[model samples]
Target: MAQSMSSPPPALAARGSQGIILKETSGSRLESTISGSECRVMEFSSDGCQLAWCDGKSVTVMDVPSGAVKYTISKPKTRCIQFSPLGSYLALWEPYAVTKDVPAGTPNLHVYNSSGELVTEYIQKKQQGWCPQWTEDEQVCARNVTNEVHCFSGGAPGLTCDNKLQIAGLTTYALSRGKLPYKIVVYVPGSKGAPCFVRMFAYPNLNASAIMASRSFYKSDTVSFSWNKKGSAVLVTTTTEVDKTGASYYGEQGLHYVSARGESNMVQLSKKGPIYDVDWNPNSEEFCVVYGFMPAKATIFNCKCDPVYDFGTGHRNMAKYNPHGNILCLAGFGNLRGNIDLWDRESLKPIKKLEASDSTQFEWCPDGVHFVTATTAPRLRVGNGYKVWHFCGTLVQCEDTPPKQELWEVKWRPFPAGTFPTPSTSSTAPPTTIEQPVQQEKKAAYRPPALRGKPYTYKLHEEEPPQRVGAAEEKEKDKLSKSAQKNKKKRESKLKSKEQEQVVITRGSKRGAEKDDALALAAQILRGNKDKVVDPVGSGKSDSEKKLKNLRKKLTQIEQLKQQQAEGKQLETNQIEKIKTEQSILEEIEKLTLS
Candidate 1:
């Protein structure tokens, strides 16, 4: 085993013969391929020095650099595997089972060390929240037990539970990473009229008196937690079994932020629909959330929960920040059309737009400049494959499974922080070595022959147009002061009065009312009221009829204003202006009838 193994390459696992292929991250070259019964589960050590996989017969751990089998444990039924941050320990989980000989069932979760020695085990019945958590130093290990959390101190080899945090209805717990004096956050679902709560506690203390932050809310049956990279705070996504409003079939969800320093806030989303995703920036000072109904909106908010930038509404339901936190990938998949949009967080400009149809998994490379998207099996039994992409939207590598074979999963090997520096933002995308088949454009839906060229006033939904990234901030900058606004209105009023007075002076001209009406029409155009004077069809007799109809509508509005004025109501500026146009409206009606 050599120190060079500290940066392992990515691994791919597919069914049938292709057990596991370790591919170099620098290019589309195969580093090594380990074939077995079937590579069902594969994981890389946090340091990337070792690679482990289970093929139904046994679990194998290999030193990445030497290509030597460092440890082999016979765990035939293992379903998942994970390695500690420092690669000091490995954890394996098997499907929970019961037998006549052992009715209660055996401990299905096993923890082992680098020497292939069993260190600990637990009976994790449910597979949902199965993996154990470890601090960055691997000094503290935490696992969820029945209505409690068991904490193991003194890292691997001689790990032992030295403390326990007890909480009734404890369903899930998350361990924060980074330096020691680690923190733990726990979730408790509500029952018996109590509200669901998520609370944080500093490590070792593990008591009520040491609780740092807590949040309580209603309508939550389960929750998922996401801690920022620095481990300063955590975002809890609360979800219910059903949405009471019946607005979404996916259920109702809310996002809440809880920091380590006793500060908490329920993140307020602008839209009123299901929350699709929330990802914290690597800097940990800001986060991005994708929420609302179909054609969802994505917004970035600061620590105070104030929106910093809105990505606007789109057919996207997921937002992911790259390893460097400089790039963001907002994508729409599953039920919506598959469109992937890459954006530069610093510039707030879109980097690239591409599509990976039927993609179910996405992962960023340790280098932060490249990513991988895959369409795996079970989620989609057909078209199981994966593609490697540059952040600038280039398809660097594409691997489609053979017709008989099905790809299950593809993973980028985990590397220690600072192992690979973030590529410069100005760098261009690498030349595409793999070509993706160009898909045909979807045709517009069929319309009846009679309505092919006819104008229609129907729309399926109000599709919001694309907006500039800083449009809101730009508008804020363009806002006028109160005094300036008042002066502007005064100037507009004087100009309108001057034009009206000029029309009155011309009322005595040779054309009389006809010339006066033409001036009034010109005034309407200057005031942005051309729609009121112009016939949309630009036709013959119908144009005159439309003008007469508009004039009668204006007279009716004038009568309503007079009634309001008689009732001692103060007319608004625009309302008073409309009243003054009444005489012009009557003159226009007479001219239209004569014409």
Candidate 2:
């Protein structure tokens, strides 16, 4: 259900080095604040009803609506927490530790109900891939075990392990979101010259015979999967450790598509480079990929793997579709200068350009009209803060970490689907009482004292500025049919060629127009064949030589076209017309040779 009057307003939570703050997103009003200990991590329940966080001592779950503490579980050393889809249970992961008393490391992964009672526990050693995967309905949960996946059916308390997917050398698995009959995809890396493979299996029947779709690839050392919102299909991105072709240093990557109905195929990327990011549209029928080298390209593809629209090329490494799938945020962060471009999905036109240099994370608010970009600790240890901006590129709120303190994380509280309606887009930013920060003017690059006065060229590697391709050219692009567009291009090319020829004709000591006239006259005389050649007394020898040279060049081009035609080469309309003029050109050349 959408947000009711009694429901909590959408909130923004930030965890700094020493404290955590939860504030209402609408007015930036502080709702809750917990301090005095290092805030480790924070998570909102899948339904956004409860907010949970760990502070090195205990895991606290807060009822978001009432701003009251719901549960305070005494699970110290917790590194991560995740709430199941329906928010009925929360899973926590603590680093595994070996002690003299319990050397095997008592279950570090624990699941607890809303009442703070431990429901289940498992021994998950490594922090990576340690979280228990849950289906959207929360009726099933699974986790990776030694070379296999153990799945449990029913709710948290007294959950029964009724299914186990035993794949030799299983590395990882992903559970799809949404209604019943959920699908799961598992990956197993290649070994001994064997190809790596992924297999999709529906819930309840994960056996080999129950596999619905499968894909195998050779160049992958590891792979990641992106399932559309509907969970009917998935995009698999495979990566290799090294590029054997030596074309790139970042390694080779490939994208493949697999659906729930036994459809599997490789997604052919047009450019050659690492696949930076792939995101499926909320509609689940289309997806976008940002890929290729240096000036990477972003393109939207339909479910059939056909390119729907190209966002041209820019310095982008990430593509994010808002919850409504109407706006897409393309950004380049880490190594590249942080530049964000927002595009309208319908018109395929850019709507805004934003920059948050040094940002390490970006996410859209469930409302879809607001977004948050943050620069936290460890990634850069500097510029640790978060900025909330209206999707129109207005900086609505900017909070920087205090000196000596660092921001650990920032997240918008999640809400159920349709809880926040999509706001109509407007170029004008809504008025906010919070004062926006004044962006600092860019400083000039430093030059050496010795070369200060010397004329040296310095080039700054800057991201390509946004160019409004659709808006500027959409009229001509949409008004013309495909063939009309092609003919238009041809006409433009011919006009350009004519202008270039005119430039050459007007250049040099001899006027090219006169030579053209001589050629025309020679062709006319050749057509008559009996017309006597009139070499005027003052007819410049240079002019005749230039005309003869032009006629001979035309004859040579015609001969080449005729030879190509004889060789069974298909000639264009203009090429065939040029071939028809071969005899006339030969007659003209004969007249010039005889003269």
Best candidate according to TM-score = 1
lDDT of each: 0.80, 0.81
lDDT of 1: 0.80
Global local distance difference test of model 2 = 0.81
Q: Per-prediction TM-score, please?
A: 0.76, 0.73
Model 2, 1-595: lDDT tens digits are 5543222336788888768888765555666468755778889987777988888788889888888899898987888998888888888999888899988879888988879989888787888888888888878888788877878787563345778899998998998976678888999999999988999999888888999999988999888888888899999999888999998787899999999988898887877888999999999999999999878988788888877677777888999999989999999988887899988887777788888889998988887778899998788787788888888877777787888888878888887787766655544676767766556788966788987878857544434443432455777788889999999899999999999998876684365556655755664454464454544224356766667667756766776788899999999999999888877877776767577
Residue-by-residue lDDT tens digits, candidate 1, 1-595: 2122223335443343466777664455555556663788888887778988888789999988777899799998999998888888899999999999999999998999889999888788989989888888888888888998988887752335689999888989999976766899999988899998999999888898889999999989889999988888999999998988998887899999999989999998888899988999989989999999867889999998878888888889889998879999999877667789998889888888888899888888777877888888778888888888877777777777888777777877666777666666678765655666586698987799988987766876565654554667568557977787788889999999999999977765536546446645654554354555633222233766656756766777787898899999999999999999987886787677557
The C-alpha stretches of model 2 lying farther than 4 A from their native spots are 1-9, 26-28, 157-160, 433-595
Look at candidate 2 and give me any clashing residue pairs: none
